[model samples]
Target: MSETTLDTRTVPHDMDAEMAALGGMLLTPSAAADVAELLNAADFYRPAHQTIYRAAAALMDRGDPVDAISVNAELDKLGEINRVGGAPYLHTLAASIPTAANAAYYARIVADKALLRRLVETGTRVAQIGYTGEGEAAALVEDAQAEMMAITSGAEPEEDAFFRSFMPQVVAGIEDRANADTNLVGLPTGLNDLDELTRGFRPGQLITVGARPSLGKSTLALDMVRAASVNAEDPAPAAFFSLEMGRNELGERLLSAQARVAFTRIQAGTVDDADWARMAEAMPRINAAPVAVRDDVNDLRIIRSVCRRMKATTGLRLVVVDYLQLVETGERSENRQQDVSAVSGALKAMAKELGVTVIALSQLNRGPESRDDKKPRMSELRESGSIEQDSDMVILLHRDDFYDQESVRAGEADLFVVKHRNGPTATLTAAFQGHYARFMDMARG
Candidate 1:
C-alpha cells in the first residue's frame, strides 16, 4: 500500500464554527481570553483560521486590540498575509458572527470537531502501526490510549495565570464544601478512625500500603477494596489489579472475609454446615458490590487500560494494585531500582489522570527486619524510595506477632501513616483475623 496522506482521509471539522469563533473574538476582543481557554489555534480546521486564532490569542495575551485590522496587522507582522488570503479573510471572519454573545458555544463546537479529528488521526496511526507490525503491540496500544486521553482531557502545557483568576474557583470550592452536609471531604475508606484522620482517600492520590511477607498487606488491601466498594446500595466502583495472586484465590478470600469464615477452610474445601450458612448469607453482599479483580495483570499499560474502560462504563473511583514490584514497566531500565521508581511515578500520574484513588501494595526491604523495633518505616519501602516521594500517603503495615509468636498484640495490626500530604499522620490499629483474612476496627470498651 502507498503511504497515506491527510488530504485523502475524511476528517470531522466545522469551518462555520471556526469562522464564527474568530468572528466573535474580533467583534468582542474581551471574550478572546475566555475563548482561548476552550479552543487552541490548532482547533481551527482551516489553516487561515488557525493563523487568525493564533494572532487573536497573541493580541489577547498582550492586552492589545483584537479587531480584524489588528489581527491582520499581526498576521502581516508574522509574514503570513498572503498565505491566509491577506486582510480579506480577517474581514470575512469579523462579518460572520452576528454577536459575540455565543462565543463560548462556537468555541465548543470547534473543540468538539478538533477532538474528532484527533481521534481519526490517532486511530489511523495506530492502525498503520498494527499493519506494519512495528514496535511492541502492547506499547503501541498504550501509546494510542495515552494520545486518546490527552485529546479527551484537553491536556496542555501549563501557562502562568494571575492569582485573581483562580481565587474564584478556590472560594467556590470552599463554599460548596461548607454547604455540604457530610463531614467527609473525600471518598470514604470505610474505616471510621482512618476516615476521621484523613477524611478518606481523595482523588489524584497515590496511596502506598507497604509491609513484609505474611503481614496481611494483601488482606488489608482487599479489606479496603471491600470497604470502599461493598455494602452500599450504589457504591463507588473499584478495580483490583493483582500480580501476585489469582482471581479465583482473591475471590475466595473475598468470600471468606465477607462471611467471616476461615480462609484456610475455604481453600481446603472443608467448610462445615455453619460456615456454609454464613457463606450463603454473604453471597448477596458480594453479588451487589461493584468491583473488578484482575489477577493476571502485570503490565502498567494493561492496568491503565482496565481503569480507563471501567471509568467509562462503571464510573470507577478507586484502583488497588496488589503489589508494585510485580508491575512491568514495559521498558528496559538500567536497574531494578530505576524501573521501580519509574513505575511509581507513572502510577502517581495515572491516579491524577484517571481522577481516582490508587492504593498500591509495596514490599519493604530487609532494613525493617534488621532493626530492633521490627516496624516498617518510609525508608524500608523496598526497591525505591520514589514510592514514598510519589505517594500522597504512605501506610506501613506492622503486625508484631507476625515476628514474635508470644506478643500481646497478636491479633492486631498497625497501619502507620508515615506520610500524609494533606492530613494527620498516625498509626491506626485494627483487629486482624488471619484465618478469615479480614481486618476490622478494634472495639473500645
Candidate 2:
C-alpha cells in the first residue's frame, strides 16, 4: 500500500454505524455503490472502507445477483488490495453478523475511521426521503424549510431553542460574495504584483510556471510556496511534488535563498565567518515554517490521497507539482502525448474538485531559442502545448544573463505574463541574485 502510487479513484470505507450494519450485504449492489461514492468525497476519510465498499459496488454493478460470492469476486478484481484482511474476510463478516441485532459490532469494526462512518450516515440520511408535493406532504416540506432557515439565519435563540437563529440578510450577503468570485482559492502570498495578476491563485485554478532548463522556474515556485506558507491572511498549507532535486539539494537552495548567502559557499561550507553565521541564523527561521515535504510519490492517486490527508490535518490551501512532465497519468498507453494530456486535464479537474490551487512547473518549448528576442511566449510550453489553453495563468521566466551580459549589467530579469485569461499581459523585473539563488523586487535592488 505504501510502495506504489496512490489510487485516487480507490473507494474509502468511512461508513457510519447505521450503514456499517449492512457491511457488504446491506440492500445489495446499489447500497455498496452509493457507499463507495460517498467515501470518495474530498472531505472523506477511511479510504480502506471506501475501497472495500467500491469493490462490492463494482461487483454488484455488473448486473449479477447481489450475494457474498459476487462481492468476494469483485474484491479480487481490485488488486494490490491490502488492508490486513481481504474480501473473504468481508464475506465472513457479512455471513457472521446480522444487521438488525449487530449494529453495535458493525460500528465497532470501523470506529477508528470517522469519515467512513459519516459517509454511511450521509446515505442513511438521504435514503427513502423523497419529496412530496401536496397537502400533508407540502406542510412537512414547509416545516423542514422553515427549520432549515431558522438554523441558518443566525438569529438569537428564543425560549425552547438553545441555539442562535440564522438571518436571511447575512446568508444573502455571503451568497453575493460567492457569486461575485467563483474562483476563491487557497490564500494570498502577499506579493502585490503576482497577487494582482491572478487574485492569488484561487481554488480550482491550475497555474503553470514554465521556463527553459535552469531559468529558475522551481525557484519562482518556491518563493510563492514559502510566502504562502508564512502568510497571515488565510495562509495556504502547501505540498510539493519534486520529481527532481533531493532533500539536501533543495534544502541548500532554500537556505541560500533565505539567508542571502552564495549557494556554492553554503554547499561547500567555505564561506567567510560572517556568511557562516548568517547561515546558522537562517536555519531556525526556515525550519520553523510548516511546509511539509514528500520526497517519494509518483502516482496521481497517492498524490491526491496524501493531499487530501494533508488538507485534513493542516487545512491545505495549495498544491505544487515540481514538474508536470514527470507525473504518470495512470494510463498504460503507448501514445505518450495522450497520456500526458489526460494527466493535464485530470490535474485541472482535481484543482476544481478539491478547491485547492494547483501550481505545476512546465518545460518551455524549444522554439524560443531560435527566436530573435529569446523571450518566451505561450507557445514555449513544450510537449503538451494545451497547457496554455488549460491554465488560468501562465508565468514565463527569463534571465537575460543566460545569453546577453549587457542585460544583466543593467540589473534585470523579466517575468513575462504570457497568458492571463482574466487580465492583461504585464512584465515585472526582479533582481536576479544568482549567487544567492534568490529573486527580489527590482525596487529593493
Candidate 3:
C-alpha cells in the first residue's frame, strides 16, 4: 500500500465532528463544561483541536470566560495560536457549527472515534506481543485481556462530576442514613459494633484486613462475606476469589460456621446424627445464598472479569480476596514489594471501577508480637506500604490469646479499626470460635 493510502486507512478520526464540537464549546460554555466530562484534549485526533480544547478547559476550570477572543488569548499565551493556524482557524470552527445545542452530540462523535482509534492501537500492540511469542501462551492471553480491559476500564467517567451535579447523590445518601433506624449507610456485615463503627462497607471502598498466620483473618473475611451477600435480608450476590485456599476448603469453613459443627469433625467425616441434621439444615441456607466462589484466580484481570460478569448477572455488591500478597500480577518486577504495591493499587482501582466494596485479606509483620501489648498498627502491613495507603479502611485482627495462651481473653479477638477514611477508629471485640472457624458478635456470645 502507498504511504498516503495507509495513512488515510490506519487512523480513525472525524475532522468535521471535531471542529463542530470545538465550535459548540466556543459558543456555549455550559455545554462545553458538560462535554468536557466525556472528552479530553487527547480524545481529539488533531493536535490543533487538542490545543484549542486544552486552552478552553483551562479557562473554564479557572472560572474565566470561554469564547473566541478569550480562547485565542489563552492560546496566544500558550504560543499555540500560530501553530494551530492562528485565530482564523478558531473563527472557522465557530462558523462551522450552526448552533451549540448539538454540542454533546458532537462530543459523543469525537469520543466514539477516539475509542475506535484506541481499539486499533490496542489490537496492534496485542498483535506485536503475539508475534514475539516470548511469554507463555496463558500469560499472553492474560496480557491481551489486561490491555483490552485497561482501554475499557474508564467506560463510566466521573472525573468531571461537578459538585452541583454530585449534590443529589450526596443528599440522597445522607437522607438514607437519617431515615434509617441505624447509622449503617452501606451493606451491613451482621456484626453490630463493627458495622456501627465502619458504617458498613460502602461501595467503591477498599478494605484491608491484616493479621499474622492463623489469627482469623480468613475467618473474619468469611464472616463478613456471608453477612453481606448470603445472610443479608435481601441477598445480593458476592464474589470470593481465594488464592490461598481451595474451593472445598473454603466451603468447609462456611459449612462449619453455618452448621455450628466442629471443623475437625466435618473434615474427618465424623458427623453424628445431630451433626448430620445440622449439616442438612445448613446445606439449604448455603445453597440458597448468592455467593460465588472461585479458587483458581490469582490475578487482577481474571478477578475483574469475574466480578464484572457477576455484577451484570446478579447485581454483585461485594468482593473478597483471601489475602492480597498471593495475587499473581503477571509482571516480573525487581522485588516482591514492588509487585505487591502494584497489586494493591490495581485492587483499589478495581474497587472504584466496578463500584463494589472489596475486602482483601493481608498479612501483618511481626511488629505486633515484638511489642509488649502485641497489638498491630498500620505500619505492620506486610510487603507494601501502598497496601495501607490505597485501602479506604485498614482493619487489624489481633488475639491476645494467640500470643498468651492462658490469658483470660482466650476466645476474644480484638478487631482494631486502625485506619478508617470516613469514621472514628476503635477496637471491637468478637468471639473467635476455633472449632467452627467462626467469628461471632461478642454481645451474642
lDDT of 3 by residue, 1-445 (tens): 3222233475889999999999988887655654675688889999999999999988875667778999999999989999998999999988988888888788899999999988998987897788788879999999999889877676555765668887988899888878988677788876788987888898899999999998989888899977876677876678999898999999999999989999999899998999999989889878998889899999876787677645543557889998899987888787999999998898888788667899999998889878999988889899999998999999899999999999999999998999899988898998889999989888662
lDDT of 2 by residue, 1-445 (tens): 2233433554344345424544534434433433332333223244455555555545544445445566556556656244616656565546544443443345444443544444444433333232332357766566655544543243554554533344665587568758766343335643556666665677788888889998888877777776777434434677888877676777788888888889988788888988878889877767766677666877776677667645543556688888887788676888766766766787888787666888889887787789878888877677776687789888888888786776634456788887877778788777777787767676653
Evaluated at residue 194, the lDDT of candidate 1 is 86
Residue lDDT tens for model 1, 110-225: 99999889888877776777677778889978876887687667566445366877799889978988998777767776567788888778889999999998788999888888
Candidates in order, TM-scores: namely 0.66, 0.61, 0.67
Which segments of candidate 1 are over 4 A away from where they belong? Answer: 1-169
Alpha-carbon deviation at 283 in model 2, angstroms = 2.7
- C-alpha lDDT score of every prediction, in listed order: 0.84, 0.65, 0.86
Best by TM-score: 3
lDDT at 395, model 2: 85
Query: lDDT: which is higher, 1 or 3?
Result: 3
In model 2, the number of clashes is 25
**Cα miss at 411, model 2 (Å)?**
4.2
Instruction: Name the TM-score of candidate 3.
Output: 0.67
All candidates: CA RMSD (Å): 14.8, 16.2, 15.1
> RMSD (Cα, Å) of candidate 1?
14.8
lDDT of model 1 at residue 364? Answer: 92
Cα miss at 70, model 3 (Å)?
45
Residue 327 lDDT, candidate 1, scale 0-100: 92
Q: Score candidate 2 by lDDT.
A: 0.65
Summing lDDT over every window of 10 consecutive residues in candidate 1, give the lowest-scoring window: 29-38
